[model samples]
Target chain A: MSTASPVLDELLDALRCLPGVGARSAQRMAYHLLERDRQGGGRLATALQAAMQRIGNCVECRSFSESERCALCAGSTRERSQLCVVETPADLAAIEHATGYRGLYFVLLGRLSPLDGLGPEELGLPLLQRRLAQGEVRELILATNPTVEGEATAHYLAELAQTAGVRVSRLAHGVPLGGELEYIDRGTLAHAFGSRLPLN
Target chain B: MSTASPVLDELLDALRCLPGVGARSAQRMAYHLLERDRQGGGRLATALQAAMQRIGNCVECRSFSESERCALCAGSTRERSQLCVVETPADLAAIEHATGYRGLYFVLLGRLSPLDGLGPEELGLPLLQRRLAQGEVRELILATNPTVEGEATAHYLAELAQTAGVRVSRLAHGVPLGGELEYIDRGTLAHAFGSRLPLN
Candidate 1:
């Protein structure tokens, strides 16, 4: 028990605001900052400021980007005809990392949650419609998560895209790789049943 | 696996860099990033950057600060005669939270890990010596951790401070709260026995 400083307290409090980080973690992080060399802290600080200063939502796909368009959107060679709808830029990134996806992306930014008052507007669906109307996008892939809200959003977007004369498809659902069928839920089971496989 | 992205891979790699967060946790965190809102990730990025940008080490106490002098160093009203030497700024914070002490602090940032090549110069012992040379500090309290490295560092600091004509004191060796004295190691027991209190 001794003299305490308020500046350090403020820094610790700011660190506390990080996700999944508790008071103890925040304190540890603060100590790490204090204990680490100026070079490390200085580099971290510079990275933070640089990201804040440069990164923003892409104008085209709403993905995080250093400019108005993200790297994917900025690239001219990638297919612009087929559009994959996802919940966030991270989802788009996830698909990109997995490879073989050659279509453009329409980042919805969020899913439909009527209870939470989040609707098509909150997800920027109007922009999606406008993009579809521009005649470049022919197919719309509903790549939302398999959760209830995600399913609902996918269904809604599929119907909307159908009316726009854009062929719609959903991500395939079944037992995940390295995952047992027993752990699969009833909804997935029902979908698997509807899309039954041929006997060997 | 229908939808995969390289961004997810990068994000996964980034997640692994965080302390105590490993591959499985990194996967969980990445899944969370895909599922959760910008509120969490955005805030983390901002906080990480802000802390790096604004926070720095205190010139006097060697704790993290956002200004030229930390709050403790800046405060003129606190006790300046006694000094509490700690392994890290978080230790100072923990002691401060427990309340009562009003002496100044001197953070070591790290303990003496000879195998890891950490030494007095790495811990800013010269600065501490200069401070003690001024003769304002009469009592030097060693509040280092109870680990072997911590004990060694405390002893080394104690010797140095004592050599500079200051009264050196080490923190008491005691059974931790909720820990059984019987379960404690033999070395700790011996130390606790040597520093035992009188029978009431």
Candidate 2:
């Protein structure tokens, strides 16, 4: 967007890169920044810089944190011996927010896809095996999503952990929270049916 | 977002604050930044700073610009005597992209809203008057939208310009280009009826 003004144009162009934002939104945000909150905008700008500077992946779980370990990793209550492995931090958050499990996490950062050339190495699975070999973990819970890649990744990881003399379990299959039965896809329903458990 | 790491948590929190982004999208963007584009993240942080440092309003038209005057303000070709007033820079861009008018612009930055205590003073009518009094203006175009506040603002500005001994014109009202009769709103259809033009 080449506006008559160069600097103003640059600012607008930069804002356009944000997810779902357009030229109009960028202009409105820029207008709000200039007219409404110079002090807040300055703080926000500073905060953005400081955050990017400080944030990095933790050595153990690959979760972002200011220090070498993340808060969850450092916490005493979280069970380190029972690792719940997932594909991303958002998945960790979703599981935590749901809150039935009381274990620590191992973020795979990605799923294995041979077609995409993202195998166990790409998913940091070799490191996971080494971490499991430390003889700390008892049960390895495969908590990945129910997609084809997720199922494939889970099976592959289960095989790896079994070879290392550890028990492997997956999060139970069922109707998801807030799921509409009518809207539920056929594959998920079939899985739920096949993996049905007795009522407690 | 209390990750063992404070930096990563803060970054995730900030990213989540962006409009319409859910936890999933936020984590994806965060991972993308961490794994692939740390330098780009750093550059975005700096870009935020640079935009704040450089962006200021155009004196003549009151839109954002790098210089004291915007590119449109400095342009020799834009008609100084023909000023088209609008509510914001977004409005200006919408009109520009629609691509008919060929004149200068004056951004009011807001609209008249009695409910919000946004009267003539709040809408920068005084600044507009100052522009009219500068004597280069031959015709002042009320190119504001035909919505309630837009109409009220246009009428108010037209009255002010008339009192200042300048001519006033309004954007024509009718069905929009590429609009279907069934889809046209009742108000627009009525306005078109009232202001029916002679057949060429």
Candidate 3:
């Protein structure tokens, strides 16, 4: 639909840049902001501008940060001997929220995807390698997702950790704690069965 | 999740002001923009700021416009004898897209809802009244939705049109074209049956 206002049209078009928003959703958002939440709209614009212009990767962990090092990297509470590698900052946040791990993190920002032109250099593996070569890290935990690309990235990182004389580990793959065996997918069930451990 | 960057956190919070977005969606949108589409994010910020700061309601139709009069109201191609009243600019766009109605329009921007504090004055009914009293509009078309509040607003508009000595009409209500009667809802089927017309 052709909006009577060119600015409204432009706003709608721009809103489609969001991840899941389409033309209809963009229209609703535009109308909603214009009708009820102009102040919120202005705030969003300011926030977006500030974030896009200022936010950059942390030099140490490669996670999003406004400064040279992220808070986790700059703080003294986290252990320097244990470093966890993850695909994105969101994954890093998930680990921090769900686990009691008090270690440093190295954010890959993306998994290994050759078709998309992301490689070791793009994932900042050289920086991670230099950190490992410094001999501060005694353990390297591979916490990338279980997808094909994630597995490949994890495999590559495992080799890197071994070459640097650091112990490497990966997240376990099995049925979830509350999952019923009957409902579990075949691949997971098979893997869990094959890798079943003896009772303690 | 607590983002490492304050600006990123602010951006995520401000994104929740949109109609259907929540925490997870906001996080995903922020990550996507930061990871793959910073340029698009910057463009959206610019567009949103311009729209929020500059756009205002057209004095004639009360639709969103940059200037005092909207293009539809200022143009001379449409017929002044017929005026179509709608509940929102989106509804007006739908009518313009679906039909060949080359007539003027009056956007209510909202319907009559006393509970929500929307009334005739809030809907700019006084401006509509003055336009009707000008003796230019011969036919008034009520194009509000079929909801309860929409029907109430349409009834109120019909009365105003009659007081101004203009012929009032409403869009026909019936089973939708190409809809199967067996699958239609009882309310619509019953209303269509009761308001059945002679074969044309």
Candidate 4:
């Protein structure tokens, strides 16, 4: 026998669509929405609907945007000669927030995962190729994550960029800033050692 | 420079109202909603609005319901002689799900927190007193959590029930089912030892 009302049960099930939100968390969220912040929940619903309706993939970079092109891609001052390719718009946002990279971006939206049937076409690689072929791009930076699929996607993109007569670069892999050596994984340590930069 | 659209940012901020949902999780949820399940997000929004509009406290139990009284309180088969007092509707639902407790319930919505200014009045103790005075309730079961505040609230309610000439009982506390003895806290272990029942 279900312990919650039908609407509450449907709300709980709907809340589980959020990443990392399991049954317990969904229940807590449902109860909170129902018992305390019904107004806030209503606002959230409106916001969700508005956002889903307004936001779409940027035509130029494929990142989420309210218009045909994202603000970053439409900016005239950003360097057109440098393009940073990331697996998701979230990664692009992280780099924009934390780094001084004043270049254009191309969000693949996902890595090439053969097991999941996600390939170049699925990631909109043809669009990326078209952008590179414009000859304005001098460098293509692979900013996909450090996972196996990310690495494979970056390698494939590098080959594509090289064939298009553009220089290719990968984000450096290293022990993170303020990371302890003892806690650093062996794979990262090895990559850091292998890719050690020279002091100029 | 904000990488997300204004609507997306609003949605992310709105999502943070959920308990334990931080900025990162909010971003992830927003992305998931936009990238994967726009329809599901819309459904959630509709459910949130509908639930907020329809669901309110049951007049008798104070638990969330669509009508004046909840289904449980409206049921004729339930034992009117036994009243179960719980801290929240979630707790009431838990008891209903885990056991064959057919008694009526009163939801406190919160425990007494003097520091937070949540006292007896905030938990609607007068309403509880009136219910106890109805003369139909013979036993009042305290199903509040085993926390300090929960215990204090339970004690306070027990005194009130005593004044009304109603018998009060507390739920048993022990090492949880499948919990290891070594991992159990000292307070729980002591309580378990003191309340040890005969194996007859």
Residue A14 lDDT in model 3?
A: 94
How accurate locally is residue A130 in candidate 4, as Cα lDDT from 0 to 100?
Answer: 91
- Clash count, one per candidate: 12, 10, 0, 0
Any residue pairs clashing in model 3, and if so which?
A: none
- Per residue, candidate 1 scores C-alpha lDDT tens digits across A1-200 of 22244544555565454457677776665566545543454444444344444556678887666566776788888898999999976677678878688988988877999898899998888889888788889899999999999999999998889778889999988766786678888877788779888999
- Comparing 1 with 2 on lDDT, the higher-scoring candidate is 2
What candidate 2 gets wrong by more than 4 Å, as runs, is: A22-28, A198-200, B12-32
Which lDDT tens digits does candidate 4 get at residues A116-174? 99999999999989988999999999999999999999999999999999999999889
lDDT (C-alpha, whole model) for all candidates: 0.74, 0.78, 0.93, 0.89
Full ranking by DockQ: 3, 4, 2, 1
Q: Residues B72-141, candidate 2, lDDT per residue (tens digit)?
A: 8888987788889988877787777786667899888778889988898777778889888888888998
Question: What CA root-mean-square deviation does each model show from the true structure?
Answer: 5.2, 2.6, 1.4, 2.2
Predicted model with the maximum lDDT: 3
Candidate 1 stretches greater than 4 Å from native: A1-7, A43-47, A133-135, A181-196, B1-60, B64-81, B114-117, B121-138, B160-167, B180-199
Report residue A82 deviation for candidate 2 (angstroms).
0.7
Runs in model 3 deviating more than 4 A are none
As for candidate 2, its clashing pairs are A4-B71, A65-B5, A66-B5, A66-B6, A66-B7, A70-B4, A70-B5, A71-B3, A71-B4, A71-B5
- True-vs-predicted CA distance for residue A72, candidate 4, Å: 0.9
Question: What's model 4's overall lDDT?
Answer: 0.89
The alpha-carbon lDDT assigned to residue A132 of candidate 4 equals: 89
